[model samples]
Target: MDTTETLQGILEFIDEHITDNISPEVLAAQAGYSTWHFCRLFQWGTGYSVMAYVRNRRLAFAAYELSSGKRILDISMDYGFGTHSGFSKAFRRYFGCSPGTYRLHAHSNRPFPPSLPGAYKYLIGGIIMEPKFVTLPAIKLAGFAIKTTSVAGENSKAIPAFWNDYMSNGMMEKLHAEKFIKKHDEYGVCFQEDMTTGEFEYVIGVERKDDAEISGEYHVCEVPPATYAVFSSPPSDGANFAAAIQGTWNYIFNEWFPKSGYEYAPNCNDFELYDDRSMPDEGKICDIYIPVVRMQK
Candidate 1:
């Protein structure tokens, strides 16, 4: 799925703040954008207005709780509704059931009356995302993107090795400084080119500056200037990277992006940033980065 880490982070703020009294201003603060910026982005990114996402998320949790056997009053209060009557009334309207009746009758697999967004759960890979707002200028890269099955399967490590071998043919020193900016991070983009099934592009390389020479050895791509939400990743290891990436994707897919107002990027790049500074002497140190553009409604 086309998932934006920024939108994912925004949804995460919603998840973290769901239990509290969250105004759009508070929610925006959590999202690292001003209320105006956040609201616009939220609306643009997600089809819902800010309040809608909060209510829908609260409702998703409410349904989960009910399915798990939590009391209606409890779900309501946890979601910030203080009165049973009010909660039940809203519940019946949104979910078409009285709380008591829902617990007694609704199947374990289903909860709520109906007419709400899907569910979201916490995950491990995206557990450490701390997103920041940034504005980056246009940059260019030289690489090839082939659709891959899944990173866990095979190509994840192999493609980078391919890039390295390609680079090692002595292309980096020959590539121009003005046209390209080399980044240690790798980019892994996932999006739905079709409904249900998703698409992925994994690219690794340095940015090509304007005057850069394009020898037959390289391919070129461009990333334009736009509002970006950046997140920091935990230090990498053979042990940690897989788990962390999985968690991040799970969080982005299962939790954050859907509610953030942004739809999947038509064609987005999921990033894996590396910090040579953080690399342990034993192996390597790196982080993941996914840049996203707002999905049009």
Candidate 2:
């Protein structure tokens, strides 16, 4: 088998024996490579060290089990975390919250299995578009804002409803009429997350002109300068536009990040830039800008 197939098999093996004691040496032996060589190959393939990947998978399963109403200690031990304290510490470091808190706002944020080249495609209609990297100046925006959470995928449901209301309630027309508006294009921006509650603020607004006067009713946000990997949704008509956009997002998080050598930049806003191309009769595409920083070695 080639390297891709070998790593895919190893990934499946890791998942199967997640709750058991799994060592790099054991996995190296399984892959028919020396431990030193296997370590390098595994990191190159998965962007995670051998044991780190195992630990993360274990924590993901542990997070899933938290909702089952099982005792925390039992769940920890089942994931091979020997002690509750050890589990809680590792859990906090990886997820930014303790087990109890994550359970209270439980949603599966598990890392999806990586898609090796030629194994599977995550885009809509099998269309693939590579992202372009760009560094942008600070941006200012003014519009409607809503508080949402990732818990139970609340943002997915809440954001669409929020948009529907904005469009139907005359808010969209009112915002565009403002003198402060820099462009007719709209932005759907997700601000940095709150680690404690898994909640964040999302804004649906247009770009604000630099010298424009502020309005009392509008929510304002300023995004600092950053480098971003920008991905465009596959071109689709009005009927399939939303699906196409969602598919690109899935591909970015599930298929790209693990192999991209970059992670989401902290304290920066990621947004969808919807311009004329996003109109029903136009290009029917939206650009997703994700701020990024090189992953630490």
Best by lDDT: 2
- RMSD value for candidate 1: 13.8
lDDT of 2: 0.81
Model 2 Cα RMSD, 1 decimal: 9.4
After the best TM-score superposition of candidate 1, give how far the Cα of residue 91 lies from its true spot, in angstroms. 46
Which segments of model 2 are wrong by more than 4 Å? 1-121
List where candidate 1 sits over 4 angstroms from the true fold: 1-128, 144-201, 266-268, 281-287, 291-297
Tens-digit lDDT track for model 2 on 220-282? 988889999999998888877888888887677656765677776766778999988897764
| Backbone clashes under 3 angstroms, per model | 26, 0
Q: Specify the highest-TM-score model's number.
A: 2
Model 1: worst 10 consecutive residues (lDDT sum): 190-199
